[model samples]
Structure formats: C-alpha cells, structure tokens
Target chain A: MKLLSIKFTNIEEEWKYEKIELFDLTLLVGVSGVGKTQILKSIHTLKEIAGGQSVNGIKWELEFQTLKGNKYLWLGEFETINSANELNPEFFIELGDLKEPKIISEQIFLNDKIIIDRNSEKFQFNGNEMPKLNSTESAIHILKEEHLIKDIYENFNLIILRDHTFKIVDLFDLNQYRIEKLKNQFKTFEEIKKSDLNTFHKLVLIYDVSKSAFEEIKSRFIEVFPQVENIRVAHNVINEHSNFDLETSLIQIKEKNVQKWIPHHKMSSGMFRTLLHTAEMYLWNEGTVILIDEFENGLGLNCIDVLTEDLIYENNKIQFIATSHHPYIINKIPYDYWKIVTRKGGIIKAFDAKDFDLGKSHHDRFMNLINHPFYKQGIS
Target chain B: MNLYFILKGEKTEVLLYPKWINYIIPHYKQVFLEKDVIENNFYIFSGGGIPSIYNHTINAIKNINDNPVFDKLIVCLDGEDIGIEERLQEIKKHIENSKVVLNPKCKIEFVIQNICIETWFLGNRKIVKKVPEGLMLREFIAHYNVNTNDPEELKKI
Candidate 1:
C-alpha cells in the first residue's frame, strides 16, 4: 500500500486546494520552520490514530492507492472544544460542549463503498448502524470493536494506514540517545536485544559479522573506513544469576586490532551514527514510507553523495520524504526531486522544481537561488 | 534555460552585473536559481573570481554536459586586468580542450564588463560628483549608495 497524496490544514484552517502529491521518493526542502516537520508530524498522526491513539484538531484528507489497484480515502475533522470555548464563550456555553478533542466528522471509503461515516453522535459502518461512538474515538478504532466491521476496518487500515509502514528517523533524537550512551553505559545489549529493534539497531544488525548474509555489508564498511580491517558484533554475557534469570547479553564490538572487544558505548560516535543510518540502505525489505529529518547530520560529503544518489535513482520500494538544511544535501539531489517550500503572507507554498524551466544547469543556479534574500517569498 | 555568469571579482562585480543588465534591459529580471525561476527562463550564477571562475565555469559546463539541466550558458567577467578578447579566447580554448560539446541551439553568449562593472557605474556624473575622483569601481559602489533602490540608474550618469 502506498500513500498517493495527503491534504490537510495544519492549524484549523479549511483546506481548499493545499495537497502534497507523493511519489515513491518525495523530498521536502525549505528553510527551518516552513512547516516541513509539521507536515511529517501530520502524517505520523495517522499512524498514531491507527495505534488507538487519539489526535486532536487534525483536519485531514488523505488518499491511498494499494498495489492491488484499490483506492482508499480517509476524511476526518478533529475539533478542540476548549480553544473554541475560551475564545467564543457564548457558542460553547450555549452548546455545553466538552473541552476535549472530538471528531466532528469522519468518513472512510474504499472505492465507492462507504466503509464508515460518522457524524457528531452516531456512525454507520458498511451502511449498518454502529453503536453510539464517543466523539474522541476514531471511527476506525470504534468500528474495530464490532466483528462485522472488523474485517472492513482491518482492510481499510492495512491498505491505507498500516502503522509499521511509516517510519520517522529524527537524527536529533538519536543524537540525544548517543550522548547519553556515550556518558554512561547504563543499558546492556540484552536490553537493546529485548527491546523492539529500531531502524538504528536493524541497520547495525547488518554488520553483525556473525550473520553470513552481512559479509557484503562488512566489505562495504571496510571500503568506506579502510582503517577498520574487520568488525565483529556479539552479545557477550556480562552478568549472570541463578537459573540464568539475570544473565545479560551486552552488545560488544571488536575491531581488527586483536584486542579485547569493546562495548558499542565506547565506539566513536560518528562511526556509530554513520553505520546505523547507512545500514538501513542495505536491507532489501522496503518500508512503505521513510521520513528522515536532517539527513546529513553525521554523514560526510562522500557518504551523503552515495546515500543521496541511491535514494534518488536506485531505490524504488520505500517512499522517502526527507528534510535537509545542508546545501550539499539539497544540491546533490536532482532539481526535479526538489519541493522548494516557501512561505508568503503566512501561507506555506511548495513549488515543484519540475514546474519551472530552471535552466539546463539548474543545480548550479539552485545553489544561488536558495541564498537569495527573497528566496523565502513563494515562487513568482 | 539555466544561465551561468563567471565574474572576475567579488560582491562589487556580483551586484554591478545585474545593475548593468537592468540598465541595458530593464524587464529582464535577474533570476538566480538559488531563488526562483521567473517566467523568462533565465538563470545567472557568479562562480567567484579570476582563475577560480575560469576553472569553476569550465567544470560546471562539463558537469552540465554530463547531466545537462542547463541548455543555455553565459560566462561573464570584467576586462580589468586581462584583455577582454584574450580572456574570451582563453576560455574558448579551455572549453575546446575539454570533453564538453556546447549545444548548437543553446544561445551561448559572453560579455565583459569593460574595465569592470564599476566603470559603468562610475561613468555616472552624479556618482563622479558625489565621490572623490579616481576611486576604484568597488570603492565608488562601496563609498556611496551601497544599497540603492535603483542600481541601474548609476549607469545613466
């Protein structure tokens, strides 16, 4: 299932024509705070809702097309009663509206069939009467409770908004983890192994030389870092207790120096960050969407080029939407991939580089255009 | 569609070329790719000064030849120290030696700011009267009206 497009207003404004059309790999480029991360977070809200988490004040209109040629549309309106009450006391006092977030209107359709449609009080599932749903609960979540609507709910969800399909790797968050881990080896490998493997660990596992499948990855790492002759990953038993109940496996890495294996906590921060980020590229199983913010956080110029080129030309499965403030990151990618987001009169506008005849040597020109004082002004 | 201008100086030359273009052709908006691409479909880039500009422009053309986003090319420089014709010939010779083949249909043009873009600005009587005589073009733009609303109007004087 792939997301075809997403249409939503960020701050309670009615969405008239604002929509982001997504390709297999879409890139969002702009200065800081032009709603790039906000756009990403809005998409993440769908995943949260899918996980039974409620989202408030999200005016969303999303469309998805499956590999099987089925199309699904989810139209939802979330209203925050408290803000309304505070600003307009007369309206909320007369209605006695609750201060929490509630679904004002919700609709989900598969092709032309109305799977679920909810008004303020009652909702219909496949044209059948559903129980009186709380305004706060999503129609998908509420419908999931009914056995009759369970299949429909699951189908709609799996095809359109599977939680696993969406992944956001914010390097800033990873940096915090790296900083804590660097200062103190508080967590053992057993903890990381027991915990759900994040993209970082999933990537690091590729170099777990214990696995025969990772030989290619090991060689690639060697090519990049010649100083490292070989890398070995293992879960060492650092602590043990009676009945093996307290045995802990610490993730350890040994370099080619023929010395004692060191904990991953002791490894260089740059290498750890680099390996974690790039290792995801070697894994063949493509995610539905991968959102990377600050893609150039720890990567060198050469590494950035490799990753950028790979994402732009080679990968076909994962739909990638990345944000970058680095000029090199923005310049390396082709102009057609650029979504020059700018704000004017407090409205964010995204201009597709393909829409403009940005000259034959646009990459060179683009480098200059972005630095121009009026670059923040929406496309003329 | 994309245009490149390899100027032989710093900000003074950078700011002056656009003013000169506006002075010559007022409606032709200076579209830097770093900003927005206007409807006229022209882009201008200044790749530093002197040998850097020469090498950078050549490499940029070659890179474009490999990828080819820019169909039209323009290389501009000041004929301050070097002879304008000699500089153009040297650039042409360098391009001929390289692997790049300029598109036959591409409108490739070369312009030299005679004595430099500063000369044109200092040509204005108002500028000459306002400033001490015999200051460099860079000094003239720098000393007075550095952030003028009408940069091109300096040419009228």
Candidate 2:
C-alpha cells in the first residue's frame, strides 16, 4: 500500500505545517540544518502512536489514509505528555463505508439476527439525536461477531503498515539474539530455546529447511571484513525493559581491510558512514522508516555523485527522511522531495522546495541559493 | 609545463593552462560526457567525468607531467607540525617518476623562506608562539598558510 499524504503539527522547524507527497522513490534534499530528518521523526512518531505505543510530550494532531477506505484519527488531551499518568484523550478508527459497522440498527446480534441496536453508545448519522450506547452491549464487538471487519487490529496497526510497506519487514531483519529474546518472552523457555544444542538438534530436522530461508535472506546483505572476516552489526543492544529500547539498528564493515595495527576511530569518516547507508538499505528491504540526523557526516566532495546515484537513486523500497548540510546528498534528490526548514522565532517551519518556485525542479537552483543563504541576521 | 591545480571547490572556471598535454581527470567535474573522454597525457584528480569539456587543470597536466620543464617539483605545505611532503610522497612519486622534496627556492618557490622570516618576525604574537631560532626555512613554510591549489596564493620570493 502507498501513502497518499501526511498532515503534521507541533514538530521541528522543518516539519510544522508539513504537507508532504510521496513518490515510488522519494528523495529528501537540502544542506545541513534544513530539517529533513525532523519530518521523518514526526512520521515515525505518528506511526508509533497509532500502534498503541506512545511517547511523551508529543502534543499535536496528525492523520493518514490507507489504500483501504479507512481513515484513522488519533486525538488526545494529556495531563502530562511524559509521565506514566499521561491519559489518552481519544482513540478510534473509522472503518470504510462498510454498512452497519456497529450493530446499532435497533438491534444487538443474537446468534444471527439483531436483538436491539437501541441504547448504543453515541449514535450519529444523517442527524440522529444523541443516544446512550448500552454499557453491557458493545456495538463494536457485535460488528466483530458478524465478521464486519476481518483484520481490524492488524489493519489499524500503524507500526505494521510502516514496517511492512514503508519500512519493509521487521522479522527478516532480526538476528539470532533478537530472535531468542522474542522467543524467551514467550514464558516457556524449554520450548523456544534455539541456542541449546538439544533443542536445536531436533528443531533443526523439523524446521531447519525454513530456517535456511531466513538465513539466506539475512546473509545476502551482510558485508564480510577481509582482516578477520568477522561480521559486526551496528545496533546497540537495547534492553526492552529500559526506557529507550529499539528492535532494529544499522551495521558497518571496513571500506578497506588489511592486517595492520589500526585504531578503530582512525578510518576515514566518510567511508565509515557507508555502514549506516547499508544497514538502512536492509531495513528498507524490511520496510522501516529511517530518520537519519546527519546524512553527510564524514563524506567528501569526491564521493558525492556516486552517493547520489548508488544510494539515493538506487534504493526504491525504504522511505528516508534525513537532514544534511552537504550538497552532495541534497542535489541528487529532486526539489519536490527536498524540504526547506527555516527557524522563525522559536518555531520550525518546513516547506517544499518547489513551493518557493514555479514550474521547474528545485534541485540545482535551490542548491545554488539556499546552499548558503545570507540570513536576515548579519552573522552566518 | 603540465601544471595541475587540485582545487578545493564546487565552482566552475575556464582553463588558464596549455592544451597539448594529456589530462587524467578526477570525478566531480560537473560536466557531461563527450567523445575522447580518457586522455593518456593528462592525469587529473578532479576530472569532470566528461571528455569533451575544457578544464584548466586537465590541460595543464597533459604531456608536461613527464617533461622536465619544472626542473624541480617544490612542495609547499602548512606548518601544523604535520609532515606534509612525507604524506604526499606516494602521490607525488606516482605522478612523476622523481623523488619529491620540500626545499627553499627564492623565486617562485620563495613561499617557504618567506614563511621562515614571517614566523621569526611575528612569532610570540598573541596566540602565536615563536619557533626555535634558526628553524630552517623549509620547515618554516609549514607555519604559513599555503594554498594547495592556487599557486598565486603562494608567497612569491
């Protein structure tokens, strides 16, 4: 499924009043401090909230449409955005114009026929007066009994949509450690322990074939270092119980490896960032929305053109919302995808590059002018 | 002379060098491709990727890269206490089949000796500390700002 458009409010300078369109392959362009990453962060926030997960201090209104005729609206008034005492003001999704979404046609279902739709919670349509919904009778549950919405929860899962369609897939991206952690959370450790030889031996015979398929997909993207040929992933080990836990992360390998005493930090900064791009591509394969804060950290002008042609233009699956001050990454993508985020007062304002211009794409012209804007302030 | 300028830039300029030499262009030249793109005579670190486009550095380094017009290739570098010529040795020797050295030449190469005098004249100023007395002129060149690409920026002795 494709995303049509997004409405964002109360976000970073580049994301406020953000109305962004998507392409089969969208390129976010701009130099550093322009706020491309902020847009990505906001969208990821909205998707996370939709999945019944919430982050504090995220005060605002946002909405999105799916290929299915479902319009999900999330609105809330929290006492405090950060603390656990934070309350959800409202949560509901409008299913497609599927008739009788709730069993309120003057009947609640009994086996098959509707017994009563009366006393349903807050009825409104074509101007019907407010009526109390029966406390004992949940109209939503009645609709579910009739198979009105088959995949209700799965369809409403914002994370699943972001991961499956936009981010790609999450299951394939998980390694052995994550796989075991998810299994251990099952409570029955004896049944789920894959690392144990006894468990692995029998399971290997039964599901070893399917396991190979998973490994085959995982192995395709891994880069092997020539020195020790050791494979290293970049994601930090996150404790789920901890306040900041993430399921996926990026990985990197040396650009050129040989046997020599070398400090880990001494590698060229530009080549080191290649690891981030590679891991990001893998997540794109799994459908993950990546928000890169600085896209041009260690890069030089020498590798600019290849970075555009190879990374930005080549990858089609993942959605990248990154902020960069370097023209190398920005010029590769089109102006429509490039957003200009300017900070006015204390608020952030994000705009499409093309909005500031007519007809032509903003790639070259914006790069020339905005690449170095002589700000209203005297000092750069 | 096959003269090349390894410019640090994103801007474009016209060639102020000769045309007979072969030019090996580096990437990021900002020009589109044309015929006769690869040249054996010129080795350019910043090729615009297109063969037909004219480049000052590309034309300068052509044919003359091997000729003896330069007499000696004098290396100018910053005095950040970092060994500049030592780092450039591999690259320099690879380009021209001669050993590269950092030395004093009073005419066009006087930038080094000038740096020597400048350090003795202005050292111990505010944040700048003076180098050891008689810190050979070649070593003093490291104390001055030397433009890697623009020869005109060099202190003309």
Candidate 3:
C-alpha cells in the first residue's frame, strides 16, 4: 500500500487542516522550528499505531491505495480525556470516493459494502446490531471479534511504516539484532540448499547466495566512497576467541589493501553513514514506507546527489518521506516532490512547492519564492 | 570581456546595477543578444558600506587574479564626505604595496559616485522633482533604467 495524501489539524494550535500530497520520493524542507521534524514524528507515530499500537489523540484524514488497485480513504478523530495517557477515537473509513463525502459520520466499508456503521450510541456491522462500543477505543481494535472482515483486516495490516533513525554517534555502532537477522537469512539459504525435495524446491528459490542483497548494497556504498574496494560480512576475532557467527557480522571494509580489512567501528562517520544507508535502502521489504528526518545529516554533496537520485529513479518498491534543510538536495529534487514548510505565530504549516507555480526551472523559482517570503507566504 | 563588480550600497545599488551596469562600465562589450532582459555576464558583489568597499575591491581583485576568471575588476564606491581623488589614491597605494600579485592581464578601474549612491538618482532632475526632499530614494530606484549616458547630467545635481 502507498500513502497518497494526508490532511491533519489541531497540531500545536494550527487551526487549519494542512494537506500534503506525497509522491514516490517526498522531501520536506523549511527553516528551523517550522515543524519539519514534527511532521515526520507524527507520521512515525501513526505508522506505529498502524503496526498495532493504541491510536493517540491526533486527528488525520488519509487516502491510500493497495497494490491490487483498491483505494481506501479513512478519517480518524481522537480526543484526550482527563488524563494525558487516555484517548477517545472515532474512525470513518470509505472504500472509494463518493459524490458527497461523509465527513461527519462514522462509517466503514469493504469493497463498496458497508461493514460497520456507528451513529451516536448505536453500532451496527454487516446488518447486525452490536452493543455500544467504548468511546475511548477504536473500532479497528476489536476487529477480531467480528471475524467476518478477516480479509479486509489483513489488507489493512499490510500497510508497513518504518522509521529509519540516524545519529552521528551511533553511525558505526552496528546493531546486534540486524547482524543476527543477516546471519539467519544466510543460514536459511544453506538449509534450502541441503534439502533434496527437487520437485517442490524447483518451484521456488528461498535464498541464493550469489543473488545476496549485500552485493547490491556494496556497489551503492562504493559509489559514495570510490576508495572502498570491497565490503563484506566478516567475524571480528578479538584475541582469537570468538568465531564468525550470528551475534556479530562486522561490516569489514577493504580500501587500499586486501590484507587490511577495517571493521565497522573503525570506519569514518561519512563512510559508516553511507554504508548503513545503502544497507537499509535495499534491505527493507518491498512496499514498505520509510520516514527519515534530515536525511542528509553527514553526507557530502556528491553523496547527497547519489542518495537523491536513488530516491527519485532507483527505488520504486519502497516509498520515501524525508526531511532536509540543504538547498543542494532541495534544488536537485523535482519541485513536485517538495513540501515547503513555514511557521507563523508559533503555528507551523506546509504546502507543495509546485503550488507556487515556480515556472519551468524549479530550482531558481523555488529559491526566489523561498528567499522572498512576502510573495508566497499568503499561500496557506 | 569577463568582468566582476563591487558595489558599496544597499538596495539602491543592487536594484539599479542590474539595469544600469551595462551603460555605466564601458570596458564590457555591449552584447545585448536578446531583446528581452537577460542576466549580464558581469558578477556583482555587495561590499556592505563605504569603508568595506575598499577592502572588498582589493580582495575581489586578488581573488580574480588567483582564479583568473574575470579579465577586469570594477569597484564602485561612494565619496562619502571624502574627495574622489583621496579614495582613488588610497586604493592605488594598496594595489602597489600588495605582496599577492595582481594578474598582469587583468585591468582594474575605480568608479566613485559623488556624495553617495542616492545622489546618482538625485542627479536626474525628473526623479528629484517627483520624490519629497530628504526622502530615501531606495524604493524609487526600483524603476531605474539605462536611458542617458551623459556624465555632465549626473554632475549637475
């Protein structure tokens, strides 16, 4: 599933519902304190909720489409009670666009059929009347109880949202869990090779070492660091005690000499960041949504070029939403992919860069619009 | 010819230079290839104020000499209570005493606006009559153009 657009309000007292349309590669750029990071954080929170966390008191109207060419529009409104931790959510889901959008009604549909309808205190689902649901819980929270809408619920679960975190200090500090996952994938490949069920096994190939994703990531990493000769998963022998196993597959770099392979911790900040980004970009499962705040944290101009190009043309399977403050990155990206954010009276707002009609040469026009705010600030 | 300019005023110079620069400096060949207004080949750098204009001019000359992109360096500044000859001599001495050598092929010229940049606008009798006395002409200069090249017309006001 791909998120097409979103409209949200009541965030930090911003009275208007700001709508942001996303593309394959969407980037948010603005001055500091303009709520660029806050937008990413809100999306990350929603993604976590979609992954089964209790929904919070943040109102949002979202539209997404599945791979099977089905569109779903959902509006969610949540209210906070006496305690800060408590939430009261009301959801409205529609299968497709209708002539009159039911803005003030609680409705849920599956394939153009009404599955759930809640009016004030009365609740009905699939023509059967049910007891009044708790005001503080979402209707989706009790989807298992019905059991009739299993396929629809499973389709909703397919929406994967992943937040990629980056910190300068932890750039090279390899996560143990990621290393173990890689080793397990390799072990799975070995197990499949040893099996002799030729008829069923020929139908599918679970994992092939030659087609390992690590090789592709290595090529991308080398593009950023041409001096990097090779990159591979190796075991770090500290005084010759431990062996190459699941807990640690240290990313080793061979630069000038094949004999001297520098481990992950020994890599520079720029090198480590480029390698980690390359690995994460290719490793994420297809159709996954990723949110990255300040994507060009430690990258140089050339590295940013490679990354933005990859985001624009290379990675179609994964959808990206990133925030950046660099003009070099902003100018290179197509203007249609930009969401220019701004703040006023402590309230933040965002609008698509294309809305300003920045002529054909978007880079020059974008700069002209941003530098002279009086010309475009009235857009919101 | 390739050229770099250093202007020592605020919006008055920034706004007026783009429209009037081609007529002000004669060293650049007037190659108005298109009828529509297009960006000039010359580069303009703001020197902040009168004093900084002198320092910025020298730095720009040295920078062009090091990289050798421009063939000429034109620095424009305001007389600002001092005579035009004194400011010219001050720049001449610095160019002669500099350890970093200037590019021999590159020629440097200094253009001093009498009193200040605003006085150039006041030089025009038509503009002086339109705005009230003692009012800043910064906003008025936004409509500046290349109409006349008469130095005597500019000197009368």
Candidate 4:
C-alpha cells in the first residue's frame, strides 16, 4: 500500500498536523523537533488500530492506494472518556481509575463509493444497517474477512517500520531446528525459488539456493566495503567445548589477504548494516512500504553513496519514507522528493521543496536551502 | 568559454553569485563541482574570507594552469577597509610571492565589490517598497537611501 496523503489531529492535546502529501520516495528534511518522526508514528498507530488496537483522542484521515490500483479514503476519530466518570462502578471502585477510548465515527470510501459508514447511533455496511457491530475496533478489522475488505486489510500488513539503530536478530538467528526445517521444506533450488518465504528465511538459504543471487549481493556489498574479499552463510559449531553438539549458521566474511573469516557478530556495526540493507533490498517482497527513521545513523561515506544510489536507481517497486539530517543525503536526493517539515507550538506543517522555488536555478541547492527562511526558522 | 570563479564571503556569495550569473548569463550552466565542468559551464569555489581568499586565488590559478579547459578566471571579493586598487595589488603580490605561473591561454579578471556585496544586493530598488513596513528596513533606507543613490558610494556607519 502507498499512502498518498494524511491529516492527523490529537484533539485532547490540541496538536494538529496539517495534511501532507506523499510520494513514492519521500524524504522528510527539517530541523529537530519539527514532528517528522511523529508523522511516521501516527501512520504506525493507524496501522495498529487497523489491526484491532484501541487508541485515544486521535482524529485521522488517510488516503492510500492498494497494490491492485484500488484507492481508499479512510477517516475516523477515537472517543476519549474521563477516567473518574466513565468507568464501570465496580471496576472503578477496584481500580480507582480507568479510561477507555473506542472508535466513535468511521467512514470508508472505495473509488468514491461508500463501502462502510458508522456513527455513534448508526452502523451501516454497503448501505445496510447493522446495530450489533463492535465499536472498539475499526470497520476494516471487523469486516476483514469480506472479499472487498481483505485486500485493504492485507495492505496494512505490508507497511513495515524499519529502525536502523535496532538490529533485527531474527535475520541472523539461525538455529538447528530452523535450519533443518528449511532444508526439508525446499530440497531443490527450484522449489526454494517457487516458495513464498519471508526475507529472513530467503536470505538464510540465498547462497545455497542461487549462487548468482548471492554473488550479486556480494558485489553490491563489496562496492561499499572493498576490504571484504568473500562472504558466505554456513554452519558453524558454537559449542566446541560442550559434549552436546550446538551449531548455527552464521554469515561470515573474509578480508583481503587474510586467512580468518569474520562472523556476523564480530563484524563492525556499519559493515553489518550495509550488508543487511543490501540483502533486504534484493530479497524484500514487492509492493512494500518501508518507513525508516534517521537513515544515516551508522552509515559511512561509501555506504551512504551506495545506498542512496540504490534507492534512486534500483527498479524495485518498494516505496521508502525516510528522515535524514545528513547534508550529503539531502543534496543527493532530488529536491522534488523532499518535504520540508516545520512546526510552531501545536501546529505542524510540511511543504514541498518546489514551493520554495528550489532547484529552479543552477545554484548550490543545499546552500540555498540552508539559507532559506523556512528552513532556518523551521516555520512557514 | 568555460569560466572559473573564486569567491569571498563563504556563505552569501557562494549562494547568491550563481543566481545572479544565471540571471545575467542564462545560457551558461553553473557546475557545482569542478569535475562536472564542460564548455559554456561555470564553476565556483568559496575562498572562505579575506586574507585566506588571497591564497585561495593563487591555488585556483595553479589549478587553472594544470587544467587548461578553463578559458577565464574571475576572482570576486569585497573591497572592505581598503581601496579597490590596494585590494587588487594585495592579490597580485600574493600571486607573485607564490611563484605560480598563470595559463597563457586563460585570462584572469577581478571584480571588487565596493564596501561589500550586501550593499550591491541592497541596490535593487524593486525589493524594498516605497513605504516600508518594517522598522529596521525603514531605518536602513533612511540612513543610506540606496533607492536613489549608488550603494557602492554609501559610507560605512
């Protein structure tokens, strides 16, 4: 699913973010405390609510396009209740405090036709009244099994949040049982290629399943870190001193003119991050929207250049919404893909780079951007 | 002709010159880096500021001598706290002390912005309104009146 635009407001807190448009590759650029990460968090919160979680006092309107070219406009608000007044008398006596927020109003439109509409007094699906529907969950979650709603619900599953600072242990956690299951499930390379496996599982067997794919990832990794001579994923015995056998598959890399192979845990964070990102880009499923925060945290100069080039030049159908304060990243990305965020008190806004007439002249665009009043003051 | 520029005032001139260049010479494209230069392209390098700009100019001359692709070199700096002739002589003396030879095919030129480049910017009459709203801008206009006089001749307060 691709988010086209969003308008979010927290009524209780009096904080509101103006409607911001999104592109396939949107990069949020601004000074700190401008609510760039809050925008991403709001989207994740909506995803959680779509998965049947209750959150309070947030009014949101999201317009997204599904993989099958179906456009949807979903808007709703969660009702917030006072803890002392709204709780059940018995529960209030025991707990002393309780506050609950539930979905109070929801409207879903598909291609401009109303698929579901619900209010405090009325609940309707396809213009049919149903008074027995639940208010604690989103209509999309309640009707997820319906044929029309299944794709929309599944699209929320494709929104993946990637934090570069946190390592995903599952990608490198290769135990004996998991390895054995993978081996038994796909005995041949063709079967491995035909199976619908996740990125972590596919990556664990990449070298064995397809040599060319492994070589491609290796070459890309080498472009960023030239010291790496070779890389492989193989079974390595962890408990050599123990009587009972304990083994796991670890990603190992050999340096130029060196006999020792460095395992994944022993490698530097920057090197490991570059390798993981390279592999994920190659193996991630199509039609996926990846949200990344602080994109340049652990990246070196060479890694930044290679990754930025891959993001711009690669033909993968993945959409990226990333935030960065690095000047190299800001200058490297085209100005048209930038959304300059600014804030004042409870109001936040995002403006397109084109609105400031950036990139229209052949000047130093980065220098011009830094000197701009909107960027300097962080308000427009 | 491919032109190379070494500018003073690390921040403002580095930003404003290309815009003015593009406005005056719309046909010539500005190259951000020297390696991207081609025919009819201009590239700029900031010298950081005054005394350092003299050495930067000599370094740029050495680079231009080694790469003969550039046909012209323009050194732009403020004529601050000194006469325009003295600033020009100071730059020449630096070049002579460095013992660097200029490329015979490429011509060298200097543009000394009198007082400062910001004064030149203020000379644009269209930017400020006749009846200004801001107090600081109104006071600045009343002190020098750039709208009616040559801003370069305005005295420092």
The lDDT of each candidate is 0.59, 0.36, 0.58, 0.80
* Model 1: how far residue A88 lies from native, Å: 18
Q: DockQ numbers for every candidate? A: 0.15, 0.03, 0.04, 0.04
Q: Which stretches of candidate 3 lie over 4 Å from their true place?
A: A11-16, A82-114, A118-120, A131-135, A144-212, A236-246, A257-259, A344-348, A360-363, A374-380, B1-157
Estimate how well candidate 1 is docked, as a DockQ score: 0.15
Q: Can you tell me which runs of candidate 1 are displaced by over 4 Å?
A: A12-17, A66-69, A82-98, A145-196, A200-210, A236-263, A268-270, A282-287, A326-336, A362-380, B1-4, B7-17, B23-43, B47-56, B59-157
Docking verdict class for candidate 3: incorrect
Candidate 2's C-alpha lDDT?
A: 0.36
Which CAPRI quality tier does the interface of model 1 achieve? incorrect
Candidates ranked by TM-score, best first?
4, 1, 3, 2
All candidates in order of DockQ, best leading = 1, 3, 4, 2
Question: How many steric clashes does model 3 contain?
Answer: 0
Q: Model 4, B20-118: lDDT tens per residue?
A: 899998999986555557789997777448886786677678667766779999999888879688888988888889898788999999999887788
| Consecutive 10-residue window with the lowest summed lDDT within model 4 chain A | A358-367
Candidate with top TM-score is 4
* Candidate 1, RMSD to the unseen true structure: 9.4
Q: Residue A174 of model 1: what lDDT? A: 33
Task: Please identify which of the two predictions, 1 or 2, would achieve the higher DockQ against the true structure.
Answer: 1
Tell me which of candidates 3 and 4 scores higher on lDDT: 4
Q: Pick the candidate with the highest lDDT.
A: 4
Per-residue accuracy of model 1 over A1-380 as CA lDDT, tens digit each: 56778877645442222678876766777767677766666777775664456565667788876545577788887774436434665444644553557788889888867888888877888887767767677776766766644543454343221122222223222333442342243244333333334544543444332254456655665666666666555433223443432222233455676577765456555555445445545553433466677777767775676678778876676667777777677778776777767665446666676786544442354555553544544433
Once model 2 is optimally superposed onto the true structure by TM-score, how far is the C-alpha of residue A354 displaced, in angstroms?
Answer: 2.9
